[model samples]
Target chain A: MKSIKEINQKIREGNICVVTASEMKDLVSELGVEKAAKEVDVVTTGTFGAMCSSGVFMNFGHSDPPIRMQRVWLNDVEAYTGIAAVDAYLGVTQLSEKSEEYGGAHVIEELVRGKEVTLRAISKGTDCYPRKEIVTEISLEDINQAEMVNPRNAYQRYKAATNSSNQILRTYMGTLLPNFGNVSFAGCGEISPLNNDPDYRTIGVGTRIFLCGAKGYVIGEGSQHCPPYGTLMVKGNLKEMKPEFMRAAVFPGYGVTMYVGIGIPIPVLDAEMAKATAIRDEEIWTEIIDFGVARRERPVIKRVNYAELKSGKVEINGEEVRVSPLSSIYMAEKIMKELKRQIEAGEFFLSAPVERISKDCVLKPMRLKEVKLVRSVMTPAITVEPETSVEEASKIMIQKGINHIPVVKEGRLVGIITSWDVAKAVAMKKVGRVAEVMTRKVITTMPDEPVEIAARKMEKHDISALPVVDAKRRVVGMVTSEDLSKLLAR
Target chain B: MMLQLKFDPKTVKKPIISLATLEASALLNIIRASVGPREGELVVEVEEGKAEKVVEVLKSYGVEVHSIKKAVERDEEKCVHCGACISICPVEAIGFDDEKRVVVNTTKCIHCGSCVNVCPMKALALP
Candidate 1:
């Protein structure tokens, strides 16, 4: 059994022995585990997924007149500035204060690419530190230390999830296609780091890893790391396990996301460690679960190996379902290759864990007590009488930022006038009143009707607005796409 | 003188396998064809006015044609220009227009769906 020192000696002598987990697996099969272990020096593992728990700690070196940052934002994503005068932690999934589409994850990616990011911070002025705020742009080079430490990442085994329900699910699993049209699995099953080192053997606190584009380490047992198999011995090949092996998690209003981490350990030990490294895609398994059920006991639709999932199609519940890898396998392979290159060039080396990851940590379910906040306000609809000129109706729409105005007569609804109808009239050069351009068949909703029903009616009729009407058919409020979105956001 | 065709392997095995041979025999000219795990993405060339016949033959063999275009097409109505598609694109096909709308450069796009898969809006699709 060759030790890690020997591996280093070989590297020093330019006889670096390293192989990817996949290659190591092949070697073990060809030369037997013991022999393969003797020859190989390191086995690299990798995973690239939406790790929500990922974040970076940065020490933005003191500004001219140092201000203890009370509030910090990196590209508009709030970062924790409570640590010190210049240090802050930015979570990957934190939505941008300016735009929901941009998040802390995007910021991390940009930093890795050496792109400049706008840094803005606000602080109460102190006698020692005079500046109250600072706005600047910084790149990775500008920060004293920009380190990524994900609380959890490359999961050992992840479940394939789909919505069996009719409603489309917007989840961290990506969008769950309606009616199980598509299934999303978030782990690089075979090639993943934790999947290969199933028992945590050499991977734990202090183990060095390639984090995002930087070097990071395992700090401790990640939050909610209750692996299906016990710490003693990871049982049967992943393929044969029942659906009970899978875990279903929900982040409440945020939708569901799996717990995972990407901490690839550099095995510095003997051949047994080498054998542990040689796990392949065919050996790892994950569950295909119907995530439609609200209970923790999600139904297992199938038990398939990662190989079958990697094939892009898998038969589950007697139907062939299209499988999409939420994790980027391409990025994972790129990481493995880069790690191999670093090792071969003696640019990077292995380090032992300071602590072993705890096996007993269980994920506690998130239970939010039911609290209701009633919104009693509804903006009254601005009505355009049927006799109003089309030009006048168009002016009203433009001013109100609204696309549709109810064409009412006296105290009752007559029709609806839309921006499209106005534009069509203008294009046709028809000089007429609202009645000439308005759609006579208007879909109206009662004031008590749920905003969802009104939204659906608008969608069904391909209209932009549904006028909220009273018992006498007089317009009271208007539910538009914007209103429905506000309701759904709650 | 090139065309890209998509086919499903689960349905049309014979027609897909015969494509390479058909190219050699001058039945069709091929640039590349990838019959991957999900579907077939082929770049081929057919004589003028004979493209319809080729599609017909492939369809008869049970291949579902996804798109028959010179390059990838992006539904402008669906795109939110969120920039999610920008990072994963192997080729710099999809980019922001001056108005900040994501526009696909049909010339550069290989229809890899690298952008399509990661698009949160589901705006990008294979062609």
Candidate 2:
């Protein structure tokens, strides 16, 4: 069994201890106040009185305002030359002693002391005028003047303003100090309320409170703010705080700190540091998500049939088998069993046509190795000859269900005619014969040439087919798109 | 048209004197010590009208000047026929004659302690 101290230590180390104010209370109750105090270094009271009485000073006005003169002093002529150089070099002179005096030496002394003084100085052995002005205007009056009715109201306003300012400051700081290793903030009212502390006054709501890079008084309450009795110290790693605060502080122009107060009994500094670390870890996780580094879920497996497979063979999807009689028989049996299972499951529908799987999987497709054009193919060519009369050629073309024919003279290649040629001539109402309209310069290819080459030549010339001829220039066969389609289908 | 010559890291030569080895004063001393006086010789020269301006600029940048003069020459046969002055010529101006005698051309010489450092013959002297 663990000792009470060990158990308390374990609780403090766990992630749950850092979440909220109530959880911290529960932890303190379970572990006892002394152990809890040891676990959490900083505590926040929800009351404005506790926060203000605790001597936690916040500056809300602009920083580094223009310098101004408070008073002036003068010195003897001999002292002026000697002390002026030293005062000028040091950028300050003692003038409080001579503030009541109004004279040239006194003014010069004031100028040397960095007081707003108009005076003359010797330059290159000649006196020259030197003008200086001091602007002094930084005080509590610069703070927003909204009145608070009660401590709770003051605390709420302070928190709201601070949170809003922090949102902006976080963004700016993120860009300006990207490498700030860790960040933490500690105070009361924002995190908790004052309990039984009469000397402390409540912080007014919306009263400007400044902390680190975050500015503003207060905003809405968060779960982290509870059981207002102690100062709350927020801690987090820089990595975590960067994005959380950077978004508001840098890009969108808001002031906000990205730290969450860890309300454990550990040292305030340690708790703040731990918070920073936790924030950094959270930021790393966020980065991972943003970069799409998460693991994907598995896809559902679906059953497929032999006819649906793109390989032109039926086999188990991932199983490899040799092309042998026994293996083929075994595959057939397996397929039968798979089909039976589908049928028993009532998934196999006879009325619905099964779709073929994608053709992308096919390794190779069958094509025509050799084409033998017999009398049937030759007759189509003969009907569209150019020498034949247009009427005769049209009659033959209509009867043969062919559109083009080779025009041969003395059994030698000459020209070709087409139904389109006769139709065009008729449309123009020309009296010319078929020979006049037939194309004389014929495009031809060899029978041995590849089908693809013939197709490319036809496409290049924008013609339908190329007449395939032998070495003796005798027309042997003709290759067309329809023939190529039939070949590809196989 | 303005032309800029950039000195990339790849091309700069090693300095004759390492900055780590000597202070600025010592370096200037070494440069000044390199020149020595010679009879009828002008050891250093500044362009006709630019001497004062050049000195001012150098001074502004903390450079020191030593003696200034014109050139001088030594006859090959004028010496005691000893080669003592050869090593004393700081700028490597002294050489040996065919008979192994010393010869000095003051124009190329900066009168430092080159021959003065180890002049066994003591045949040469500075004005």
RMSD of 2: 38.2
For model 2, report DockQ: 0.01
* Candidate 2 local lDDT, A1-490, one digit each (tens): 2232443353345421222232344555466555554465322222111111111111222223221211222232111233222122111111223332222222222232334422222333212222233223322233222121111121221111011111112221121111211111112211222221111222222222222112223322222233221222221122111111111000112221111111111112332222321211111110000101111211212232211221212222343211100011111122223322332343321111122112121223346566443222322245244456877877777887667677776666677777788898898886366788888887876655555656656776788766666677667666665666565577
Give model 2's share of reference contacts.
Answer: 0.00
Off by over 4 Å in 1: A228-271, A294-297, A367-490, B1-68, B73-127
DockQ of 1: 0.04
Error of 1 at B81 (Å): 20
Model 1 TM-score, all chains together: 0.60
Of the true interface contacts, the fraction found in model 1 is: 0.00
Estimate TM-scores for all models: 0.60, 0.19
Q: Model 2, which residues run further than 4 Å from truth?
A: A1-380, A383-386, B1-127
Highest-scoring model, TM-score: 1
